[model samples]
Target: MKIVRPFSFVLAIALFTPAIRAQDGVKKDDKANTAISYYKDVRPILQQHCQGCHQPAKAQGGYVMTDYPNLFKKTEKEVIGVVAGKPADSELVKQITAHDGKKPAMPRGKDPLTDRDVTIIKQWIEQGAKDDTPASAKLPTVDANHPPVYTQSPVINAIAYSRDGTLLAVAGYHEVLLHKADGTALVARLIGMSERIQSLAFSLDGQWLAVTGGNPGRFGEVQIWNVEKRTLKMSIPITFDTVYGASWSPDSKLIAFGCADNSLRAISAETGKQVLFQGGHGDWVLDTVFSVKGTHLVSVSRDRSMKLTEIATERLEDNITSITPGALKGGLQAVDRHPTKDELLIGGADGTPKLYQMFRTKDRKIGDDFNNIRNYGTMPGRIFAVKFNADGSRVVAGTSYDGKGEVRVYETTTGKLVSTAKGVNGPIYAVAHHPKESVVASAGFEGIVHLNDAVTGALVRDFVPVPVKGAKK
Candidate 1:
């Protein structure tokens, strides 16, 4: 079955075959391009045919085909340019074959960007492009400085890279029993939590692991374990209710959580002290997060509001009365902050993930129109989980579309949907990006983790040993 993309978009695979390419990472002289190295000759081809609009500053119709990363980063629409290395499986080539200049052609206007130009883009991206930036004038590209994140596991749910991205804390049931990013090997299993773990986070100093959303005896639960001691430290009861979210502050001085309680509460990280708790929402509190500065925290609730609180003073700073366009009757499902920028991105039970100004103060009411200032827009599904990529330039969201789900990648500044991994049979329960590599681990209704190529959305690994629900030991 052929999925069609425009002339520039082709889901090409970029793989190096051992049969032809040398096993030592170098390809044999006769080996073909992996869609990446095909760049040197293809840049001019794109510049001449498609660069009039799809250049750096302006990508037409939200699509840019100038470079490999930007091309993949800008648009992952079905049948688009270079789907990795699969040439015969590319959509661009197919579109070129369609010469009617009908609704389905490239460059879409006066002159069709010729068939040869389309072929070169398909071949170059698959072969990989060369770095053309002048070291003196151009800033370093993310790829040149930071590599892809967690490459193993394929599907990542809750990932907290040790302060340095050198170590990772990943949670899953089956064999995600535990592995390190470096591969030195250590038992990932630490006992006492429920067999069904949901989210994972590490303390600021990397001394503890806070695992939330699993069984809490019958009081439901939230427990903190000391990593070095390997013993349970303190247990915070979730008021005999279901748990929704959990997080630790940047200073390691506080631990905050949200829930059926309708409001978010902060407690002392060391004493498990009730730092402060408020109740106002008539419904559940779905997600909560602490800003990187440690000065504030934000929460999304079933009350149809996004609330930001100043932790130190225990005061409400800004309240996003309703996250949806019309205050839609749904809850906010997930929330996350940027790595360095003063911005907070939120996802809702309805299908839009809105951004927020992290610097907004309590006295200045952001009001309902806050979305206008923060770049609010629609999402492909009910955003369930959200996390920033290593640099915070992009965001990863787990979404639900028509009861089925996938993870979507978007630019933080423009609120544009750049990539999506769809067609999963059920709602995606969670989505998380790797701290260091282009690896993503997502798990939903079926329980098995679906690891996908974070950049291309291709299936990289299936962590399901057995039909998660259909088979039993």
Candidate 2:
């Protein structure tokens, strides 16, 4: 006869065997029934592909997918976008599903969604289309009426004067504040969803303002605002980080900007469609400027090089800077095209304001920085901003170091120092010259907008762009 095991041992084996089987069964069920999250899965797909055209500011075809509730609402065609527990019957599923080998009808002009993304969206709807967006992820409604309240002055990354010299646009938290040229009164607050305003530019005709920025890690956006109507005309979401150096084309038909992803991009100012894309930079592209005629784009990058790209062909025409190692002392941070010429005013980590011809006139040589026109006297710190006057006769550069900032004006041709602005403290990240007047606007680590006389460099006036909770307006 077989030896009998102890009673305790037998009991333990029996208990452990069923427990292992039960655990395995639970894990398998969990793996099969995993819930698809609207916030985590579906939202990102929409944000990357659909939100640009379907947000509140731009409800394409009278349908919006920016919010979960909007997905279930009926579209302009009276078709429900999503129907809970029935993916096959949902209009959204129908629109996204290929038919007769034809591409999906939605996301017009863009590539069809990947099979995986479409499957995820369908699965989410099939699982009852529940709202699982966390409260912490919800952003407060911010607009002109419900503007962002500031406890302290936000870091000013950019400032611009309207083409007509009537209004000044200063970058603030989630908004661009329009002030009178004299800085005595606030005109209007143009607000958007981007938290960081990296650059601001007004169209040549002064009808629109182009803004570039975004949540640092989430997304980048190019915002076109109708200045006269004070309304957001277009919001084009781009790469997965903040964008910089927004500049409008001469005809105001296109807006170009630099990206943290080392690419340069341009989009139609009207429809927000990407019309141009150039990805030649080796590092983060920090600034960009369009050639005077708008035929080409010049982008400066943290790779310590300036590159020229042909807009028509999306071809990288040349590296404007020298290809020799260590030609640039450091990465470039700012660039501005001359008002009427194919010349550029640039500044960056080296603290020198440089003027460079946009196009190469001679054959390329590896060691030659042939396009470099002139180099102004080095400032005390890194130059974060450089701008040409309305006539391109004078250039202003702003810098910051050792917790102090300085603004210097130089004669563009002779490289003669015009004046150094007085009474500037903190790191200066932005500077703008009035289109018609002698006023120069500067702001940075300190949130106050300082208007100085461009000729004499005397402080004209300074004011906080935002309303401080306890301070006078």
TM-scores for every predicted model: 0.58, 0.87
- lDDT of each candidate versus the true structure: 0.57, 0.86
Which candidate's lDDT is highest? Answer: 2
lDDT of 1 by residue, 442-465 (tens): 666654555567677776665542
Error of 1 at 438 (Å): 2.1
lDDT digits (tens) for residues 1-473 of candidate 2: 12122344346434443223445556744532667778767887788788777766567877888677789988889989899999998998898888999999877777888876787788888889898988998877665557898889999999999988889999999999999989889989887878899999999989999999998867899989999988888888887678999988888898989887678899998788888888788777888888988899999988788999999999999998887987879889999989999999899999999999999999998889999999999999999999999999999999999999999999999999999988788899999999888878899998988999999999999888888777775
lDDT of 2: 0.86
Could you tell me the TM-score of candidate 1? 0.58
After superposition, which runs of candidate 1 have C-alpha atoms over 4 Å from their true positions? 1-177, 181-186, 193-198, 214-218, 227-231, 321-325, 361-367, 371-377, 422-425, 465-473
Spell out the clash pairs found in candidate 2: none
